[model samples]
Target: MIDALTVALGVTALLLAAWCGFAAYRDQPTKDWHFIGMAVVALLAVVQLVIGVVRLAGGDDPQQGVAIFVAYLIGSALAVPIAAFMSLTERTRWGSATVSAAAVVLAVLEVRLYDIWGGVGG
Candidate 1:
């Protein structure tokens, strides 16, 4: 993984997590901005996944981290959209809160991604 791009994705993840956390605590509706943020994060994740696969094909060792990293990637990619749709079904603050929780998951996955590459990341 490219260090700088991973850093950028991580920063985005952090912001998303904070926003989601606040939304959950306040029992607020999930905002469009939240969806937008998730979409952007997803887009970045797609790029990261591509890079990862390319590196793997190029013989960049995963150092035993590949399985978890790939799993995290799939989880991170699915979380936002799936949660958003599920949240919409309930129309309650708790439904929205599910989305917030998903955001946190996505953010945490980014950290895992960094560590998977054996970077001095957290």
Candidate 2:
């Protein structure tokens, strides 16, 4: 289950980053792909919540697990919806900028997840 989640999150991050990069290049409006990417990321994040809680309950305690896990889940859940709404409010390059923001946050969360799994010295 952990491996599946890691793979899912990693793949979603890569795909979303690629889409954001492409959007940056063209200065075009968001397509369905962005929504799809965000949806997938959000789903994976929910799955991660279950996994994290189970691990913590099982005595497989991670260093700083609670804070890190909560932050990661919040970050993952916020990125896409916030970006989409913010982008809609502005009908310009700022929309693409929102994508960039979402991509960076998602990437950061991915790293955080990795660090949490690895414990200290990550």
* Model 1 local distance difference test score: 0.73
TM-scores of the candidates are 0.80, 0.76
After best superposition, candidate 1 residue 8: deviation in angstroms? Answer: 2.3
Which candidate number maximizes TM-score?
Answer: 1
> What is the lDDT for 90 in model 1?
64
Candidate 2 lDDT, 1-122, residue by residue in tens? 55457556767766776776678678776667776767777677777777767876786756556676667766776776777777677656657667767766776777777666763431
Off by over 4 Å in 2: 119-122
* Per-model tally of clashing residue pairs: 0, 0
Best by lDDT: 1
